[model samples]
Target: MANAASGMAVHDDCKLKFLELKAKRNYRFILFKIEQQQIVIDKLGEPNESYDDFTSSFPADECRYAVFDFDFTTEENCQKSKIFFIAWSPDSSKVRMKMVYASSKDRFKRELDGISFELQATDPSEMSLDIVKGRVF
Candidate 1:
């Protein structure tokens, strides 16, 4: 449903798919995009997909929203995982696209209840594995 305040709506499938990822380990990541004024699922990553695969999914000049089920090892050797909500507004993307994605991010994020971390990335370097790991620890 569309949020009146942001003039954007997140499609129902987005939440359903996220639930599968969050609960069932059904996906590695989900790519989201704005189409027809609504947020929709653009792609799904396989459970075996690597972080590099997830990062490669974005275009160099577009804005997107994504959720990645990140698995990591703690310093103590514990296996841990976190769900990351990423707002990707690449520097080369259009100004309007960036604004709309930024404005709609909160509204859209509200639909997915279990996100563990949120990252707003303008450059690919900002969300790199090293940076993400540093933030998590």
Candidate 2:
């Protein structure tokens, strides 16, 4: 199917793989660049709660996610940008969430942003977990 934003063709197989990884929470990060019509599932570094402290050692706008970047760039580029947010749940079983805005690199920069991060960070009592449990297309 053609992605509305970039008109880039995305195959069903690719979408399926993306969904599968998301549901399983198997990937450390997922980048859906509309211009490429490609969903890149990344297994980056380990999840660390001390991300904030780690990023603080670097210069401003550098290493927003401590060791990772909003654009999912290499360690070098991650030290050059700071346009992302990281949050942690207050419950006993704390959960960490990262939020960022993304779209076609050549098109607008903030398209397809916030929704997934909001949903992921939402209080379990506010929304039905079933939606996340099933196929989310």
Candidate 3:
């Protein structure tokens, strides 16, 4: 129930459940956005990786719109917690989210999107290209 649009990082058990659902059906790859101003998916792939291979893996330009979910309970109450779905977009950066998902991870749901990124090897200073909010989306 968290970041349903993109995908959630759940515990190993939760991950199993998620994978089960994923394999069961082709729900929807609703396009989302990059919530983070900058993301670094350093493993862009191998030395001779082809562009199509990269895209097949996950295009650097593509992104998923998502929301965060949180709860205040310690353990027992945790079961009541969840961040539900809102919508998805291939280009979340193009627009501002219309709603807030929740607090904590939920707090970040509408704040922004996430992306894969890497520092410019030639200029690690990041001044030349840090992938700002306005550009890459």
Candidate 4:
């Protein structure tokens, strides 16, 4: 499906992996990158992975997209899980790459269908676990 605004198509496998993460709890996160004008899966993190593993997958000077399954305990001590859509455009990434990722993010995210939170980050601090927990609680 080519997005009219960005002219980028999201590969079918991306949605499949997202569904697996959302419904089956089969993955900790999914990393995506744009290649040949299409968004494709770059990696799939194991179900028991840590946040550090997810953060480490992103390149220092590139733009990417990801979905993370965040599990946390609420103030009442109730366990909850939320899926977050993250747009990763690091500060050192090329300006053109950043622009392209920004422009296509919405269209790409729309394809995933069940994200509970959306985060746009240019720096690691912006999308830290603390920030995610803050958003949840």
The C-alpha stretches of model 4 lying farther than 4 A from their native spots are none
Q: What is the C-alpha lDDT profile of model 1 across 33-84, one tens digit per residue?
A: 9998999999999999999999999989999999999998898999988999
What lDDT tens digits, residue by residue, belong to model 3 across residues 77-101? 4432222222222232233322321
TM-score of 3: 0.20
Q: Clashes per prediction?
A: 0, 0, 19, 0
Instruction: Give the candidates in order of lDDT, highest first.
Output: 1, 4, 2, 3
What lDDT would each prediction earn against the true structure? 0.92, 0.29, 0.28, 0.92
Sort every candidate by TM-score, greatest first: 4, 1, 2, 3
Off by over 4 Å in 3: 1-37, 59-137
Instruction: Please give the RMSD of candidate 2 to the true structure.
Output: 15.7
Residue-level lDDT tens digits of model 2 in 1-137:
44455444543443454344334433333333222344332223333323333223322221111112222334455422222222212133312111121222222222323223333222333223343323122
Give candidate 1's error at residue 111 in angstroms: 0.9
Per-residue lDDT over 13-100 for candidate 4, one digit per residue giving the tens place of the 0 to 100 score: 9999899999999999999999999999999999999999999988989999999999988889999899999999998999988888
What is the C-alpha RMSD, rounded to one decimal, of candidate 4?
0.8
TM-score of 2: 0.27
As for lDDT, the candidate ahead, 3 or 4, is 4
